[model samples]
Target: MNIQLRFFASVREKLGMSEQKAVLPPDIKTVGDVRLWLISRGDVWAEVLAPGRALRMACNQQMCEPDTLISEGAEIAFFPPVTGG
Candidate 1:
């Protein structure tokens, strides 16, 4: 499936892009799957998306969890968790 990915804050700086379109493999069905897939690319990918990272996700502009199922044209966002005082 083809999905749109948006990276924000530090994540965006690390990846060097704000957004991208990805054609995911059939085995990747959810946001978590996408994260793992990217990590598989090694180096920066593995570090940015490392296991247990406190990252936040959004699907189609709405906040979502990693288990959220994504479809063609769906927009997925990743960033560090936000905090408020």
Candidate 2:
């Protein structure tokens, strides 16, 4: 499936790219699977998207959980939790 990936805040700074297009393998079915798939790329992908990290996700511009089902041409975004000082 073809999906769009977006990173924000420190996640973007850490990954060095704000957005990109991805072609996922058939095994990747959910937003969580997408994270694991990206981590498989190693290097920065692994660090920035490591398991156990506190991250927020969204699908198609709406906040979503990692278990959310994804589809072809979905837009997935990752970022830290919103905070205020």
Best by lDDT: 2
Stretch of 10 with least lDDT, candidate 1:
44-53
lDDT of 2 by residue, 1-85 (tens): 9999999999999999999999999999999999999999999989989988899999999999889999999999999989999
User: RMSD, model 1, all Cα superposed?
Assistant: 1.0
Where does model 2 exceed 4 Å of error? none
**C-alpha lDDT of all candidate models, in order:** 0.90, 0.95
lDDT of 1 by residue, 1-85 (tens): 9899899999999999999989999999888899899889998889888978889989999998889998888998989998899
Model 1 TM-score, all chains together: 0.93
RMSD of each: 1.0, 0.8
Clashes of each: 0, 0
